[model samples]
Target: MSAHRMSDPLDRRRFLTAAALRGATVVGTGVIGATALGAVDADAVFAAPLRRPLDPAVPAGAFVEGRITSIDGGVLEVAGSHGDYARVRVTGATSVWKVRPTTAASIETGDGLYARGVPMPDGTVAADAVWVNIVNLHTTIRGIEKTRLHLAHGSHEIVGNLLPATSSASYSGAAPTADLSGLRIGQGAQVLGAWRPSDDSVDIVRVAVGPGAGHRR
Candidate 1:
């Protein structure tokens, strides 16, 4: 067999480094601070330390924040909430999270996403990390059941599904734990998790109650 040509178009090494760097999130820190991508050096931005403080900056450039409209192999067509569109290319090195750390195969059309990566010459974003159906909401627990929690966010009520093995809690600035005993009804909390499109419910990653709830980082 002939020797393979060393002319692969994509630089996998650099992309790997970016993925490794961006994957760092402090334990129990669910919120992400996305700064403007235009002025940032693409090489360093992915390696940049994610600040703990919460800032709602929408990462521009090759970053896509929206719902997946279509999937063609590893390519995802996304429709942004704001009248924008993006095409994201997922690869083996891409880190995916849907409720938990998962793989690209778990992504489906209609799943909401936030993908950040470098832009190829063809205008497709080569994703480093993709978070599917992820939502971080600040709500007050109105009611609690064995498997679900009724939450009130402003005037909208939401049903938060609790997974016995997956759902967790962080109480009063403590680290995350599987215990739900401390959660009190009517307590203000932050729910971070994946949204279930079929039922409009959330499979919670964890419910945070304490001095560190909400967008307090």
Candidate 2:
């Protein structure tokens, strides 16, 4: 059966609209805060930090992470990381963010995605928000300087730059602190940052350093 036909038209629209609005509000607040913190370039702060992974035991609606295989109309066919398949339906109200808040048109096939939305009975996820190509990396700090950290994520060496006013660090989930002086060379850290569109570098948003730090999303 078609996923779109499973719900009452009005009710489905209302649900999706509410979900999208909520997602937009969340992203909008982050962007405003980043801007206030000297992130003058919209693209630099578009991908806000995702502090932790969603709990698998929680009953929160659907959260899908994967690479997009195809786009047909407003629907995206995704090949999930865990070998599952998902059909994500995007709508006019869907909040899509790449490096910054953008329209759904900015999404492309082969892009990696993380989507939050309501799962429909017919197995399609009605997406409220989608983040494209955002990367959360756990690595060891090989070296550090006043403005950059040289990191080793597996075999890849990543250069992460600290945004002066927006970059922050947290210890063991405590409140984030602007002072990054506590970071040490060879420490394990997790970086919540945006991957450069065509490069291996990242623009650091928040760094979490402590025990068990090399956790993947």
User: In each prediction, how many residue pairs overlap at the backbone (N, C-alpha, C within less than 3 A)?
Assistant: 0, 0
lDDT of each: 0.71, 0.68
Clashes of 2: 0
Model 2: per-residue lDDT, tens digit, 121-181? Answer: 5577767567887888999899999999999999989999888887899976777999999
Candidate 1 per-residue lDDT over residues 1-217, each given as its tens digit? 0122134333333543343345422222222222222222333434542222121232233578999999876678999999999988775456577887655667888999998776655677767677899999999999999999999989999999999799999988789999998899989999999999988999989999986335464
C-alpha RMSD by candidate, in order:
11.9, 10.4
Q: What TM-score would each prediction reach against the true structure?
A: 0.72, 0.56
C-alpha lDDT (0 to 100) for residue 168 of candidate 1: 96
In terms of lDDT, model 1 sits at: 0.71
Residue 68's lDDT in candidate 1: 91
After superposing candidate 1, which stretches have Cα over 4 Å from the reference? 1-13, 16-61, 211-217
- Record all residue pairs in model 2 with backbone atoms less than 3 Å apart, i.e. clashing: none
Q: Residue 138 of candidate 1: its Cα lDDT?
A: 95
As a TM-score, model 1 comes out at: 0.72
